[model samples]
Target: MMFEENPPSSYLTRAAHSEDSQETITAVSHVLQDQENTRPVPADNSKSFAASGDLPAKPISPQQRLARLRLLMSRQKAEYESKIASLEQRHRELQWEIRDTHWQLGQQRQRHRLAEMRIRDAERAKEDAERRNEMLQKEMEEFFETFGEINRWK
Candidate 1:
């Protein structure tokens, strides 16, 4: 009923006059076929349609197909570029973390060395203190023995 009112030729005529007519028509046909179960009118009726100052439906052109292919390639390129940038950023962050870890390890090694030195010094000081205590105990025993002998004589 809708085709009877506006006619299929009128749609093709408009499509033929557009810059990217073939692509537009194909897109419209696909949409119509999907949404309303409609089929594009064939080009075999061009003679009759032309006689009535209209055009007939034609297939998509090579130029239009190439344009769609180019568009798809560009989108894929953009997606890959985005992924590469993210990976590079992650790599940089990982490098910084590794550097920080190395620094911390160096600091810990230095602290361990200092603590070892302090422990060695403490051991030496304790040995010296023990030797002095032994000497003082011997001197006190000799003094007490001499005092006991003098008391016995008195």
Candidate 2:
């Protein structure tokens, strides 16, 4: 059986389903049973494999299978760690972006408030100037009337 390309899980599934010889099926089943019994329990850290460095309970003389399994486990662990690091970095970047957006929003709000205040101030100044102009015009009218009367008397 050329199962070099397929993973163990798929290989086992294919073997189990195919119409292979009874002896082959029995041998594969025994191997799978042994693997299940010897599989290490999952742990929180990557050091789990290092902590339990014991070989399988039924050690096969052909070290190829054991070495292949170890290689697969290591590759899986490395992939998971890489994914976790990438996600952590992405999370940090998103947090910084959120903070920057919040700061920009606050700045825009402040600027909007300042603009509103300036508009109000400008309107107030315009009203005050109009009132002063009205007062000056009335005073000038009164002075001109008084001057005309004095000139008529002269």
TM-scores of the candidates in the order shown: 0.53, 0.53
Q: In model 2, what is the error at residue 23, expressed in angstroms?
A: 15
Model 1 lDDT per residue over 1-154, tens place: 2223333344445666789866566744643334233446557775558665464476555565546535644665687688899999999999999999999999999999999999999999999999999998998898889998989999
lDDT per residue for candidate 2 within 111-139, as digits (tens), equals: 99999999999999999999999999999
* Candidate 1: regions farther than 4 A off: 1-59, 150-154
What's the lDDT for all of these models?
0.68, 0.69
Residue 32's lDDT within candidate 2 is 51
Collision count for each candidate, in order: 0, 0
Q: What global local distance difference test value does model 1 have?
A: 0.68
Clashing pairs in 1: none
Worst 10 residues of 2 by lDDT: 1-10
